[model samples]
Target chain A: MSEEIKEILEGLPFWEHLEKEERELLERESRKVFYPAGASVYSGARECLGEIFIQKGILRTYLLSDEGKEVSMYRLRQGDACVLTASCILPAITFDVEIEAQTDVEALLIPVGTLSKITKKNVYAENFVYKEAAKRFSDVVEALQQIMFLSLTQRVAAFLLDESAKNHSQLISVTHEELARQIGSAREAVSRILKQMAKKGYITLTRGEVKLENKEEMYKLLN
Target chain B: MSEEIKEILEGLPFWEHLEKEERELLERESRKVFYPAGASVYSGARECLGEIFIQKGILRTYLLSDEGKEVSMYRLRQGDACVLTASCILPAITFDVEIEAQTDVEALLIPVGTLSKITKKNVYAENFVYKEAAKRFSDVVEALQQIMFLSLTQRVAAFLLDESAKNHSQLISVTHEELARQIGSAREAVSRILKQMAKKGYITLTRGEVKLENKEEMYKLLN
Candidate 1:
């Protein structure tokens, strides 16, 4: 594999221990694709779904409820794989969720058929992919715990803290409605809470963005 | 390879396609252990916990809150595998939850070390373990979705429905307090709701039990 490709695989838990030849084979199989912000990668009724890896930028996985409410399942940042990894292994039907580029994004799109063929022929490939799935599953479990135990305000606070850790930014660039969808609440409820938090100097809200004014205070409120 | 062991493997997703020889080898490695009702398998303070598959009887997983409130995480009935598989692999300094047998139980306990060795030596074992983890993760995600989307009454109704499906019984052999713990609500609140439900002819409550009087009505109320 090229040095450039090797570096990318190094950070990925599954590919870290791959042999040079095996790494090269996988690199050969993978192809890069890009989508602009707000562009839909795949919708519920679309075909041509496959394994997608976030090479750069952010994306959100969401489903439309029967009532036309948007339910945000998760957000995938740079270097993270899509939440629907298992869907790639068993491609029997179209998925309900739509994968949209939250920002101008680049991804490695590996065809499901090609992936299955590689895994069948290579034990290393199968182990790597399954292990990656296991990690994703663990992450999903943690997300579940949060949704069950945390309130709407707490969930948003947790999200802010998580994003701050990732981007080191006090400011979070998301609208109240988007944040409400992520936390599984009404936009009015979110707006009301944000106003309260801002009044107490816990956060600063202006237009569509929010900035953490007192991290310690916000942390206390969350806990 | 014995036919008896091969038959048992067919019941589990992990060992589905194994050759007779491989099945026998796995059976040889597995050890059946027994625990009486109320026996603790592993406390939240323990480490290096292995996988426990309930061959018979039941087990309960729970965590105690700071205020000494015990929250029931899950109940593992006969044939249910311990869902906290990743904790063993990741090796936490202390266990995250306590597992206690709720009845005289027979279990197949697979040591983490032995499983690790098997995974390194055999492709089937590795795939099986990862697949099981993936399934458990999915269950956890579903639980999270329920917690986020369902109301308190809906959750209780859904829990009853889920229990009925599992046991084929309208009578769930658990207390209102226990139900509250699982649902993360107060015991008094659960009791009040049960009384209201009973008055509405949706359910019947007695000492240490709650029975569905009208499942269709309960389902309607849940919706």
Candidate 2:
């Protein structure tokens, strides 16, 4: 069990920098959690969830407004940890976002107290958390810029192009409603924009997928 | 000179957490910079500025669209540090926002290399950076929520109330153009909204300012 825990820790990018004692403490204290796809992993305020380190699959972190509008913040991929959970150092800071499993996820859950203790004593762990937080901050800023500055059509085109590239395929397996939620727009608006894109020969939309036809046009729209 | 540096360092909230050697290095290496009101402090891409610790006054960090529209991200006041400048930990992560002196500002600048070195070696320093980054991340997320989920009128009303409260005056000393820039809206649109509010006896708009008349109605609009 100890060796297995060590192996799991070693798989993380920053684990090699951890001290032996720190690794041992983490192995002994942290709990492993598994969530199937579409499962609501964590929600409510930041205090509810402890420090989460994704070992496999993906988590979608988002915010839902009082009026039921949802804005997708960012995705937590494998080896990504929730830096916001380490809020002990940040006073009354609150993370009012929800985390859901986008795919079957295997994650390590460390209690906030344990993580805070380690962060206080271990430079390597603190650096890892700091870097993760910084990266997430940049991501949030980029998402905000897209939502505020870009037109709905431009956003949809850019999303299609980026998703296609990310999946290494011209066909993106996503729905217009999903796209709307991702870009923080209405479903009808997203569907209308996508239909227009199809009319322009930029993309071909089916029931739940969109196939890219003119990558150049889509890139132009993105610009 | 060394005593003066120590005194300056001690003025910071995180100063006592730093080790003696870290404090000495910061005293020897960090440079103090001052910017008058409305001065462009940091702009362009992420490469220009290093880690910044604001000692006095206010710095407004904002994002500008291709069409020249601006959205205020957050403000860094006294004892606040720029977490974006700690991007040395995450390679290729860029912060594209522009920083301007909202008021006459005094700040401490540390080279990227020095910050990176100390962050890697000192847990206390890393904790300071992590907390700052986490706080900024929360701020960005909140800003994104406002941009994506709230109505423009609601945002404007909320902004007025918040600003009034912050200044301890019902009279907000700002132009409609400045308000539009802060909320990422057109100047004409903001002016129209303010006019409508004034017609409804919610506010009284002057040449370059607005005075709140009905706080209850403004709060109602915020809801």
Candidate 3:
């Protein structure tokens, strides 16, 4: 298990830069964890969960409302790290959020204690965590700007473009419900918007796929 | 000038916790900066402005759209410190945000070099920046959730409650335009909603003040 963990850690971007002592501490202390699809990974008001380094699958961070509405904040892909759960050492987190496994996830968690000690001792580790946390902060700011300042149509266009670019395919395979979940909207609302876009010949929506028919025009919509 | 700065530094929450060395470095390097209302303090694609510790007035952080729309992200008030401007050390900031002075602002600016040196040598200073940055992250997440998940009515109600509590008064002094700016809405929309709330007896809208008549009922609307 330790050997496997070592291999996994070595695959991470931050691992190579970690000093010898820091690497030793993590090799001794890091634990592999798993979450099935749709599992609630982190909820607010819990014990510190330290930092998570994803080895497989997607981990989503979002906020839930009293009415059961979920607004997606950002996602962690394989090789990504999240410092949000390490709230024990970060007392400035004043709000609660829900994190879930969008797909079955395998991750290595550095416990708060170990992570704390390493950050205290290593400036690079501290900078790494601070940078990771700031990335999420930037994502949240962008999401807020989109929702509050832009139209839902623009958001839909940007989402489709983002998906297409991310997957490196003109034909994006995603259901209306899934897109709605990612964009924080009603499924019906997303479908209606897509249908209108399809009518306008910007995209072709067939079943669960959105094929970009006018990619340039769609890209122009974002700017 | 040095004595006045020392007096001002003694008033901050983080100043007391800073060690003698950290305090000396800051006192020697920090400078008082002022901005008039409507001044743009930080924009993306610039040199690191270091972190600003507010001495007086309000500094607003927001995102601007090409269509001239402005969405407020968060605000920093008196006695607060912001680590976000020190992007020289935080390369993980991937998005650009505009920071403006909402009021004629006076603040203590810690140059990026001094901040970098202090955090590298002082664990407490590092943690202090981490905590302050996390507070802004938490605020951004909350703002995103509010914009994407909740209704405008609930947001207006909650805003009134927050202002009332912040000012420790039943009556809140703010214009519709100012309220719209804070809530990331339009003046017409805010006025329309305020009129409806006034008609419902939840609030009384004077020219520049919102008197919370049924404060309990307004508070319950948030949940």
- Listed in order, the DockQ scores are 0.30, 0.59, 0.56
Query: Model 1 off-target regions past 4 Å?
Result: A1-29, A42-48, A62-65, A68-73, A83-98, A151-153, A220-223, B1-29, B43-45, B62-74, B83-86, B90-98, B220-223
- Point to the candidate with the largest lDDT: 3
Listed per candidate, the RMSD to the true structure in angstroms reads: 4.5, 3.0, 3.5
Q: Against the unseen true structure, what C-alpha lDDT does each candidate score? A: 0.69, 0.78, 0.81
Q: What share of the true interface contacts does each candidate keep?
A: 0.29, 0.66, 0.74
Per-residue lDDT of candidate 2, residues A161-182 (tens digit): 8788766899987888888888
lDDT string for model 1 (B105-170, tens) is: 987766666666656667666766665555655554455545655667888888888888888998
- What tens-digit string does per-residue lDDT give for candidate 2 at B92-181? 356677888988998788777777877677666766766676677777777777777788898899889988877689998779998888
- How close to the true structure is residue B43 of candidate 1, measured as C-alpha lDDT? 68
Proportion of native contacts present in model 3 = 0.74
Write the residue-wise lDDT of candidate 3 on B1-223 in tens digits. Answer: 4676787667655676678888888889989999999899997656678889898888888787777787877888888887778866765666677789988999888889998987777655765676677778878877776776667888899789887886689998789998888778889988898999899899988888899999888878777
User: TM-score of chain A for candidate 1?
Assistant: 0.82
TM-score for model 2?
0.88
- Per residue, candidate 1 scores C-alpha lDDT tens digits across A58-150 of 888765644566656667887777636336463221235567888899877766666676666666666566666556555554455565566
Write candidate 3's Cα lDDT for A31-148 as tens digits. 9999999898888766678899898988888888777788888888888887877866656667777789988999999899998998777655765677678778878877777776
Q: Is the docking of candidate 1 incorrect, acceptable, medium or high quality?
A: acceptable
**Interface RMSD to the true structure, each candidate:** 5.1, 2.4, 2.6
lDDT of 3: 0.81
